[model samples]
Target: MTALDTEVAQSVGDIRESYLAQVGRRRLYSGLALLIFVVLMVSGFNIADERNAGGFWEGLHQIGDYPGEVLTEAWQKRADLPGLISEFFPALVETVNIAAVSTIIGAVGGLILSLLGTRGLAKWPRLIPLFRRVSDILRAVPEIVIALVLIFILGGGPVPAMIAIALHTAGALAKMFSEVAENADLKPVQGLASTGATWTQRMMLGVLPQVAPNYVSYTLLRFEINIRASAILGFVGAGGLGYELRNAMAWGPGRFDEAAAIFILLFSTIVFFDQVSSRYRNRLTEGQAQ
Candidate 1:
């Protein structure tokens, strides 16, 4: 080959080798990361199993035992199932109400927090970080922790659960609402501002109109989540279907029928809400896209 051709060929070969080496290094790093993740997962599972009240292997086969007993008892007392459900219907209504009220209050609080935290939308730009930190702290606290503490002070009732769920919902929704607000078209806000509109007016007329669909969708999903949370809080003396379930469970074998009724009610309610929320969310998103 000519000298020039030979030089070019050498350069090309070196480039190809370097590229291959880089690719090999990337693959090696990726494999190492995957290995570490697997190790951590296995170790975490083993640790959790060790600390559990029943060993994983020992309880694995018996996982169906409780459900089986419940089902058998429920079948034997099938005639009483409707009566049991009716008796606990009030508790179910309380759970629903708690979720509903909490969602409404939380959504409103979150709307304010999101507006205050978002850049370009904040009524007080200097307080954005403070608002964000407050939201983070709220989201970090568990609903059960808040519920139990409130119950101690207020006595057992649905109010504590409602407030606990609302606080958590507000914090959780604030981050999401702020993200949506950040992407909102600023033209409307600017136009409104030129008309001597206040921050509240601009937000309500300009920003909220644009983000309402997504906000409502998120609120509905949160409502579904709050229902389950309220029920759980009830188990800790907050008072709801969970309280009824706890009472039934404490009665042992004879009360399996009652437990089964509560389980069916809870499961049915969850599924119903999930389906309704999913349908509405789909419609909202589709409408927004249009």
Candidate 2:
């Protein structure tokens, strides 16, 4: 080969080797990162298990024991099951109401926060960062913490749980809503402004129409989650099926049937909502696509 051709061939071979070396280094780094992540996860799990009231292996066999006992007692007193469900129906209603009210309140609050925080949609663009920080603080605080604190102050009832869940929902939904708002078309907003529309008018007529479906989908999903949270808060004296369940457990062996009834009610309610929410969410997304 000519000298220039030979030189070009050598240069290409060097470049190919360098590229392979870089790929090998990246693979090595990725492997190391994955290994470290696995190690941390395993160690964290071990530490948590050590601190738990029951050991994992010891508890594994007994996991089915309580359910089996509950089932046996429930089956023997099957005739009374419907009556028990009827008795506790009001508590179930209270739980659902708490979830529904909280979801509505939170959705409204979140909508305001989202509009305030989102770029190009904010009423006051300069205060966008402040609104975002407020949302962050709200989201960071757990629902249980707020519920427990409110329980101490307001006395244990559905109100405390409802407020707690609403606060959390507002923060959580704020972030999601802001993300949706950020992508909203600004042309309608500009057109409305040209007609001397106020901020509320622009948002209600221009922005909300575009994002309403997704917002409703998110709110429905939140309602499902809030139902569970309200029930759990009830265990801590908020007054719902969980309160009844706690009472039944406190009564020991004789009240296993009552506990079983509560279990069935809670499980059925959760499953029903899950199915309904999933169906509605699917329809909303499909509608949005069309």
Candidate 3:
């Protein structure tokens, strides 16, 4: 080979070596990460098993016992199922109402937080980190923890559950909304700005229109989640179907029929909302694609 050809060949060899080195490093990092993940999982499971009241392995075999008992009792009391459902229907409605109210409030709060935290759309760019951290804190806290605290202060009711779910929903939705908002086209915002529109005006007229479908879709999903959360909160004294379920279960074998009815109502409501939300989300996704 000529000198020039040798130089080019050497450069090619260097590039190939560098690429192989990078790939080797990536593989090493990935292996370490997998090892750490496995360690954490094993250790966490062991710790939980040790601390769990009934022990994980011991309880594992008996997990189906309660369900079997509930089912048997429910079947024997089949005639009372209709009456029990009717009696608990109002509580079910209360649970749904709590979810609905929380979702609306949360959606509105999430929109504001998303706008303020998103990089390009922020009203005060310098405060982006602040808003983001606030969202993070809200999302990081469990709904049950918040509900318990609020129940203590608010004296137990749908109100505590509603507030707890709303706070968590706002934070969760803000993260999703910010992601969607980040992808929004800036041209509309710029146009509005040039026309002397205020920040709120630009957001409402320009950015919001673009992200509204996604926002609504997220809200619907949150609503479904909040329904379950509200029910759970009810068990902790926030009155609703969950509270009724808790009371029924507390009464033991004799009240399994009541528990069964509440379970059925909760499950049916969840399935119904899931279907409704999924349909709307699919439509929104299709519209966005168009």
How high is each candidate's TM-score? 0.97, 0.95, 0.88
Candidate 2 per-residue C-alpha lDDT over 65-127 given as tens digits, one digit per residue, 9 for 90 to 100: 998999899999999999999999999999999999999999999999999999999999999
Alpha carbon lDDT of each predicted model: 0.95, 0.93, 0.95
Tens digit of lDDT per residue, candidate 3, span 84-126? 9999999999999999999999999999999999998999999
lDDT of 1 by residue, 148-229 (tens): 8998899999999999999999999999999999999999999999999998899999999999999999999999999999
Where does candidate 1 stray beyond 4 Å? none
Question: Using lDDT as the measure, what is the rank order of every candidate, best first?
Answer: 1, 3, 2
> Where does candidate 3 clash, by residue pair?
none
- RMSD to native for every prediction? 1.1, 1.5, 2.9
Count of clashes, each model = 0, 0, 0
- Report lDDT (Cα) of residue 226, candidate 2: 89
Where is model 3 more than 4 Å wrong at Cα? 1-37
What is the lDDT, from 0 to 100, of the residue 213 in candidate 2?
93
